[model samples]
Target: MEDAVGYRLRRAQLAVFQQFNEAFAAKDLRPTDFAVLLLLSCNQGLKQSEVAEALGIQRANFVAIVDGLEEKGLVERRKSEKDRRVQALYTTRAGSDYLKELMPIWAEHEERLIARLGGTRERDQLIHLLKRLCD
Candidate 1:
C-alpha cells in the first residue's frame, strides 16, 4: 500500500493541502478559491458556466465558491454585454492587489514543494507526468 501510486498521490495531496491551508489561513483562502481568483484575474468577464467548466467544478458547487469570493469583495458578477441573461465574472481592484500579495506566498509554497521533489528539473518532470495523467 505504501508503494502504490494511488496511495502516494493521496498522501502527497493531503500534505500539500495541509501546507496550503496553513499558509493561507490568515487570508482565509483555499485551493479552490485561489484557482478561481487567479483565473478571473487573468481572464476577466468570463461567464459563470464557462469558468466552472474550465475549472472542472460542478455548477452547484461553483456558485457557492463565487458567492464566497463575492462576499470577500474580491469578485463580482456583471451582466454580460453580449448576453443580457448571462452573468460574467470579474476581479475587483482589491482582488488584483490581493493576488499580487499572494504571489510571493504562492511562490514560497511552490518552492517548498519543489525542494522536496529535489529541484526544478524534477518539478518540471513531475508536472509533465501529472499533466499526462490528467489528460
Candidate 2:
C-alpha cells in the first residue's frame, strides 16, 4: 500500500547509478567517462556532435567532457578529412588498453548488480521496460 510506482522506479535507478559510480571510482573514472570511452571504442571516427546525440548529452555539456578526455590523452580530436570545420573523436591507444583492463571489472560489476536484482532475466526485463518508457 505504501509503494508508489514512480518513487520506487526513481529509487531503483538512483541505486543502480550509485553502484556504477562506486565501481568506476576504483579506476578514477566517472560513469559518463566510461560511457564515452565505450562509445568511441564501439563506433570509431564518430563526430563530437554524433557522440553527444548518441549519448543523449547536450552539446554544451559534451564539450567539457571532450576537453577533459583530451587533456587526459585518452581521446583524440582530429579534423575531419571531409569537413575542415568538423572534428571527429577517437580513442587513443592508451585509452583502448585502459578499457581492456577495466573490461573484466565492468563485467563483474554488472554481474553482481544483476545477481542482487534477482538475476539476468529480471534485469533484462527491467532494462527493456525502461527503454519502452522512453519510446
Candidate 3:
C-alpha cells in the first residue's frame, strides 16, 4: 500500500530478510553473515576491505563481522601475500558445504518473490532496473 519506492523497498526487504533469518536459523547465521559467506565463496581470495566494499559493509563493523565468521569456522583470514598488513578472506570447507545446502533454499526464497513480482522474465528485468537504481 506504500506509494513511495523507498518505503516499498524497505517493506519488501524486511519481509524477505526475516524469512531468510528463519531459514538459516538452524545454522545460526544472519542475513549479513550469509552475504559475507557468499562473497568469500565466490571470490578465491580477497582482502577483507574488498569484501566489505563489494558487500557495501562499513569498514569499522566489517572487521567484527569477519571475526565472528572466523570464530564460527565458516571463514578463514590470512595475511595477504600482496600486503602483509592486510588480511585476505576465504571460505573454509565448512562454509562451502554450508553454501551448497543453502543455495537451494535461497532459490526457493527467490521464487516466492519472483512469483509475487510476476515471473522469471519480469524478475530478471526488475533486477536489472534495481541494479541501475543502486548504481
Give the better candidate number (2 or 3) by lDDT.
Answer: 2
lDDT of 1 by residue, 28-88 (tens): 8899999999999889999999999999999999999999999999999999999999999
- Candidate 2 achieves a global lDDT of 0.90
TM-score of each: 0.95, 0.91, 0.92
lDDT of 2 by residue, 1-135 (tens): 249878888887799788887877768888788899999999888999999999899999999999999999999999988898999999999999999987987998899888998999999998999899889
Residue 62 local lDDT, model 3: 95
Which ranges in model 1 have alpha carbons more than 4 Å from their true place?
none
Cα lDDT, all candidates: 0.94, 0.90, 0.87
TM-score-wise, the better of 1 and 2 is 1
Q: Looking at candidate 3, what is the lDDT of residue 21?
A: 82
Residue ranges of candidate 3 with Cα displaced over 4 Å:
none
lDDT at residue 72 of model 3 (Cα atoms): 84
The better-scoring model by lDDT among 1 and 2 is 1
Model 2 scores a TM of 0.91
- By TM-score, rank the candidates, best first: 1, 3, 2
